[model samples]
Target: MTPPSAPPPPADGLLAAGRRNLRALAHAVSHPSHPPTPLFADAPKRWQRLLPYVVVVALVATFLPLTITVLTDYGMSGGLAGAIAAVQTVPLLMIAHRPLQAWWIILPADVVGGLFALGGPASQSSWPWTPSVIVAYLFLMLALALRETRQTLIGVWLVTGAAGAVLGRLFPGESDGTNVLLLVLSAVVLVIGGALRERGEAQRRLVEQETISEAERAHRTLLEERTRIARELHDVVAHHMSVITVQADSAPYRVGGLPPEAQAEFASIAASARESLTEMRRLLSVLRSEDATGERAPQPGLDRLQQLVEATVRAGVPAGLSLTAGLAEPGRLPQTIDLSAYRIVQEALANVVRHAPGADTRVSVSSDGTDLTVLVVNGPPAGPASPVEAGGAGGHGLVGMRERVRLTGGTLDTGPLPDGGFRVAARLPLGTKEPVSP
Candidate 1:
C-alpha cells in the first residue's frame, strides 16, 4: 500500500506576512512613484527617528483642550472642575496606550458622570452635549478606527451601537447629549478604517509586483548588453579567425615546393580555425531559458578525443590520448561536464600550437565514478615561447579553459614545465552542473 505522500509545505503565517509587508513597505517608500507620506516614509534619519515622538505630542495636545473644556462646562465648581479634568485626562492617556481598554473605561464613567451632574443647578446649561463632547468623540472614534484590525473593528462598532442605544434611552430628549453623535461617528470611523486597510493591502501588492517588474527589466537589459558584447566580439575576434582560415587554406598553393605533410598541416589549421569559429558562434548566442530555432551541433565530448588528437597531430603537435579504466560509460557524465572536458583538451592543444609550436603533447581523461580529470602536457617548444597569438592578440585561451572547467565544478592547474614545456591539467567532479551567471 502506498503511504500517503508527505503533505505539501504549510503556507506562511503571521510572521511571514509581517516580514513581507515590511519588505513591501520599504520598497514602496524608496520608490519614486510613491507619495511624500509613504507608509514608511524615507525622511532624514533624525526626523524619521523622531516621528513617533512628534505623533505622541500631537495626540496629547489634541486632547488637552477638550479635557479643559469638559472640566469648565461639566464640573460643578473649581475643585470639582480640576478633579473632572484629571478624570478626563486619565482616559486620554489610557487611550494613548490602549484604545480599546480606554473605550471600556471612559464609556461607563462618562455616562454615570453625566447622570449625576444633572442634579446640579448649572447641569441644564450645556444641554445635550458638554462643550468638550465633539473632541472626545472624535478622538476616540479615530483612535479605534486606526489601531484596531478590521475584524476587531466590527466588535467595536457593535459595542458603540449598544452604548448609543442605552444612552439614548436613558437620557431621552434634551439630555440625549452626544449619544446620537457617537453613533454617527462610529459608522464613519468603520467606513474610513476599512477603506484605509484595503488601500494599504492594495499598496503592498503593487509594491511586490513593481519589485518583480524591476528585476525582469534589469535581466532584459543584461541580455541586451550580452547581445551587444557578442556582436562586438564577433567583429574583432571572428574576423581575425576567418582571415586565419582563409590564409591557412590558401597557403599551400601560395608557395611552391611545399611538402605533402606541410600542405596537410595547413589544411588541418584551416579546419581547426573553422571549428573554433563555429563553437564561438554557439557560445556567443546562448541565452538562459531560450529555445533553439534549429537542431544545434552535438557538443564535442570525450568520445571525440581521437579526432581531436589527430587534428592536433596534423597541426604539428604529435598528440596522444590516455583514457582511464573506470570510465566505462562516458555517456553517463553530465552533458555540460562532458562538453567542458572536451573543450579543455581542445584549448590546451590549441595553446600548444600557438605558444609551443612542434611540441609533443599528451591528453588524458580519467574518471573514478565520482570525479573526472583532463590533463594536457606539451614538451618544450622548438622555439621561444610566443606569449601572444600570431595576429598580435594576447589570447584568453587559458582563461577560457579555466572558466569551462570551473563551470563543470572543476579546478585547472596550468604553468610552465620545469624543463621549459607547458602543462594544463583540469580536475572535474561529477554529479553537479554549475549554472551560468549573467
Candidate 2:
C-alpha cells in the first residue's frame, strides 16, 4: 500500500484564504451597484421635468463651497486645492449609478487631500480628516450602503478605518480623534441606509406577487367556466342522441312489410346510437362530482329574459327590456343558441348590478329574420359602489359570457363608453346549427 499523504501546513490554508479575499475585494471594487432612485422624483411635474439642470447646478454649488474652505482655511495652493475638491465632489454625481467606482476614486483623493493638509501652517489643526472631507465621504458611504451587499459594505468600512489608522500612526497629528469620529458616524449611516433599501425591495416583491396571483385567478376562473359550459352542452347533445335511438328502434315496427336487410340496418343504427349515449353518460359523470345533484334542473332559454329583467328591477336597479315581435316564441332558435343567448344576457346584467349598482340599464333583444342581437348597456354608477365592488370585479362574468358566445358561433362586443359607463352587445345567428358534442 502507498504511504498516506501528510496534512498541508496551516500557513498554506491561510495563504489560500488570503488570495480568495483579495479576489473578492477586487471584484467588489470593480462592479457597478444598483441604480439609485432619483433625488427629486416626487417633486411637482414641472420641477421634475427640469431635474437634470437642477442636479447640475446643485453639484456645482456644492463644489464651490468645499474648494473655498480648503484653500482659505488650510492655506493650500489654489490649483492643488481646486483639484482635490473636484475629485471629492465630482464623484458624488456618479455615486448613484456607480457607487463602487465612485468610492474608489473619492477615498484615495480624501487620503491624499488630508496628507497634503499636513504640510499646511501649524495653526490649522484639521489634519488626517478635515470636516469637509468627512461630510463628502459620509454621503458616498450612504449611497454605497443602499446599493452594495453587506459583505462589500463591511469591507469598505474596514478599509476606510485601516487607511485612517495608517495615516494617524505615520503622522501623529493633533486631530487624531477625527478618524474615530468619522468611522462611528459612517457605521450609523450604513445601518440606516441598509434598512431603507431592504424595505423598498420587499414592497416591490409584494406588488409583483399580487399581480401574478390575480392573473392566475382569472385563468383558473376561465377554465372552470369552460367546464360548466361543456356539462350543459353535453346535456343538449345527449337529448338528441336518445331521440335518434328511439326513432331508429321503432322504424321496422311502425312500417309494414319491411325487408330483412332494412330491419337489420335499423337495429344496427339503434345499437350504435345507444353505445354513444352510454359513453356520454360516463363523460357527464366525470364532468360533475356525485354531490352535484342540484345542477340537474332544466336549462333556461330566451323566454325567461322578461322574468330575469323583472327580478333585477326588484333588486333596485332602474332597468328596461325590449323584445322583437315573435322573437321570444318557443323553438324560434336552436336549443344551444337559445341557451347561450340567455346566459350571455344574464351574465351581462349581473356585471352591471355588481359593478354599476344603481346605474340606468337597458336590456334589448331584436331580430332581422337572420341574426338576433342582445344588448345590455349601463350608465355611470349613480350611488357609491358596494363593498364587493370595492374589493374587485372578482367574478368570471365576462369570461363566461365570451365562452357562451364562442360555443354558439356568435360575435360579442363589450367595452366602456365615453361617459363613464359600459356596453355589452352580442349577435347570434338565428339559423345556427345544433352544436356537436365534444
Which residue pairs does candidate 2 place in steric collision? none
Q: Distance from true position, residue 323, model 1, in Å?
A: 57
Candidate 1 TM-score, true structure as reference: 0.43
What does candidate 2's lDDT look like per residue over 1-438, in tens digits?
999999877998999999999778766656654555454344578777466446545764786577557655787877778888888778777665567777888899888888778767777777688887887788788878877877678788888998899898888854658899999999999989888878877987998999999899988898889879888988888878888999999999899799999999999999999999899878878877678863667778889999999988887788999988777788787788888888988898888888888899999998888887989999998887788786885578889988887776678899999999999999887674553332
Q: Give the number of colliding residue pairs in candidate 2.
A: 0
RMSD of each: 20.8, 5.6
* Alpha-carbon lDDT of model 1: 0.66
* Cα-based lDDT at residue 314, candidate 1: 91
- How displaced is residue 404 in candidate 1, in Å? 24
* lDDT, candidate 2, at 208: 95
- lDDT tens digits by residue: candidate 1, 300-408: 5678888999988897778898987535355677656766787788778888888788888888898877788888998888766555665545344665675566556
**Model 2: lDDT to the true structure:** 0.81
lDDT at 204 for candidate 2? Answer: 73
